[model samples]
Target: MFTRTLLCVSLSAAAMPLMADTVWMKNGDRLTGTIRLLDGGKLLLETDYGGSIPLSWSKIATLQSDHELLVKENQITGERAKSLLASDEGKVTLANGDTPKTVELASIKQIMKPKPFVEDFLWKGNVDVAMDYKRAESDTDDYDVDLKTQARHGKWRHNATVDYNRELRNDVVSTDNWGTEYALDRFLDEQWFWQGRLEYKRDKIEDLARERTVGTGPGYQFWDNELGALSVAGLLNRTDYEYADGEKDNFYAISMRWDYNRYLVGKTFELFSTGEVGKPLASVADYSLDAEIGLRYKVTDWASLNMKASKDQVSGSDGDKDETRYTVGFGVGW
Candidate 1:
């Protein structure tokens, strides 16, 4: 009889009973319950009216149920009915004539978002062996040893950077420079943001000068949590400088930035302040100011340890100068 009708359709597909998967994590979050056991590594979901939700499984990555169960039992019963209507005996309800109360359960406040950046999309670069001490004015004491490398990626969301430098100047062991920058960002509502950047530079002791810059901007992200976001941005820049002696210069600049992110011991801390101002294209010449301060430390998700202290002062020309640079670094892919 067709082998007993294929053994009664394989025992009715093994007596049907299976549908539970949807856990996805690593920071983007999504759940659907029904694990019931995993132990040490965590995971005990069961959730479908019959609650129970213990998680962790290395912050899950995947687990998609065959047909159901992946977090949606009426959105966990509307978050347990909005935590029992924000409790206080669920605001006691029993108006007149009859009594039927059993709604207590409110003490709400569970908000999550912002995790999963375990180095999300980063590809760092580093190399620095320093010993530079110089006393200028007539140049007498000088020391050198400088090499650089840099690479960065998203979670800046979009970024690109390149750098290079070889030491020893006044004593003329010449050659020092390389620079590149590319950036693009967009996030319009969660505060507001929009950005664009493009830069290029080549400096071989100043005279071989080559520079280019383009910028666009608008940013204002009052603040965002999980320890990051506090912004201010405004930019408009255009510059071109080419000189091998046959001089040429064109300028226009205006910039600003103030940004920060937090986390202490485990690392991850960033702070920033920036400024720029320059103007002169046709004449009516006069305006220049530049500033900076930056810091970063993140041991790993990829790798990081950075420090920066900078200053550049220039105004009107003549005898105007002020400069300082200090950097300690390490960084790698995310």
Candidate 2:
């Protein structure tokens, strides 16, 4: 009876199957594969799907067996060695030659997913609104609301703004003035861009000034978002202005702009100066210098507010000796 019981136990142990092997990496990575070689501190492996892979030993954090196997005692050598194969109900030997403890493949937790080759794509836009009041040392109080929007996609961008104000004190002209401007930009590469813009102004006095500007120059992207970018564009401009008397003038200008995000939480600075040359349109000629400084605040993802103050000096006959304007407004962008 004792011999029969021992035979039954040995047969059961030999019939059990081994569990899968799991490989863990020091970089918090893991894989499941059969180790083919552990020579020279590196591992050559065959994954379960049958692909061969090589792993540097320096990159491995730990290795564990899935099950335990037992080896019988050798009476002649007076030594006992354990099997390295895993089993559901038996102890196994580890790579370190240590006797197996309870090891369960089903309990191993996956750490993280494989790293991606590219990160997220970003998009952004903003609009602003604000009120502006201005008074000359000897003129009536003028007030206006300003609106601005900035938008961007990939490496391309655009910005637009408008102002509506009561002319309160200027003589020779009515009490209302409105003006608008637009610009489009293209990023040539990671560090440079090109841009163009158009601007128009109208007063109740039936007088108008229109400008079409196009220039290709380098731009530096200081900051940016999905909707727009803050950059400085060096520009060479061609401008034409028309008066109520049907007189017109054209000139060249050099300009630079500092733009902010649409969200209205940034600042912008600009400088403009025209060369002394005149286009022979309507025999009208003029040269001007202009500068602007502004600030914007984002009210939300869709809307924002901004304020800008500008100074201009024209050194030609039939033009203002000098003019200045302060503006504030709000706008929305999709």
Candidate 3:
């Protein structure tokens, strides 16, 4: 009985590789791992020994996967397959039950594991905090916190963000502000969507004490993938502003908003920018622009070091405001 148990355990260990996804290279190399996703001509494989490795789609001779995945072809729609079977060079067969379909790998646009249920979604976000303290001649303290998150399910996507900043120099408060925003997008097609947004901001040290905005418009998603994403929208907004002196102004505005991010060097570094520019119709403000650009260096899978510069400007208001800030901080992302 002891000899039989040992033989069974050894056989099970030897059979483990058969269950894993695999890719064969033209140079006669074989890799066994869990296939993560394919995007932008790169296939990501999660390996026990090497972590996540990205292989060039062009260099792969053949591949197979044991997990059900959604495979898109020619940048069009996709089909779900129970597993992938290696066929000839540069080809794969999608095994679904009794009916199997073979397709050229070069025509495959993207491949990703599908969520188990319709209610499942993909969500990612990050939070960054920056603080500075100095004790020389004068004491200075500055704190900035920014949070952003987004979730997508089926045709609907949700986004929310919050920002807070405070600075004190020589025990005197120089800046204090906070803002929160939420937006929802409903995709009409592959690249078009409708977006509705609401925003509110408050400043304790600026002439503009409070601001609120509501807007809706059409947006275009340039592209979104594991590497990065870019989208732009045009909006018509109703905005209300209150001054510190108890004065209020309301106006209608047309604005353009953009959000973009790109990952580099195997996703170890990211460059991102997001902002909105608007022109008010009633002359409440000649033009208003709020924008931020930042870079992040991934220290680990979930931790990062980031540097950001942002500008907020408003002209032709009762109290014109213009401010620029720079921050260096650490963040956690998922």
Give the TM-score of each candidate: 0.27, 0.45, 0.76
lDDT of 3 at 230: 98
Runs off by more than 4 Å, candidate 3: 1-18, 23-31, 37-43, 48-119
lDDT of 2: 0.48
TM-score of model 1 vs. true structure: 0.27
What digit string (tens of lDDT, one per residue) describes model 1 on residues 103-163?
A: 3212111212222322345443333333445667643322222222223233344545555
Best by TM-score: 3
The root-mean-square deviation over C-alpha atoms between each candidate and the true structure, in angstroms, is: 17.7, 20.7, 6.3
Off by over 4 Å in 2: 1-143, 169-175, 205-216, 225-230, 260-290, 295-308, 327-334
Model 1 worst lDDT window (10 residues): 78-87
Which residue pairs does candidate 3 place in steric collision? none
Between candidates 1 and 2, which one is better according to TM-score? 2
The lDDT-based order of candidates, best leading, equals 3, 2, 1
Write model 3 residue lDDT over 182-249, tens digit each, in one string. 99999888789999999999999999999999999999998786568899999999999999999999
Candidate closer to the true structure by TM-score (higher is better), 1 or 3: 3
Model 2 error, position 46 (Å): 48
On lDDT, who's better, 1 or 2?
A: 2
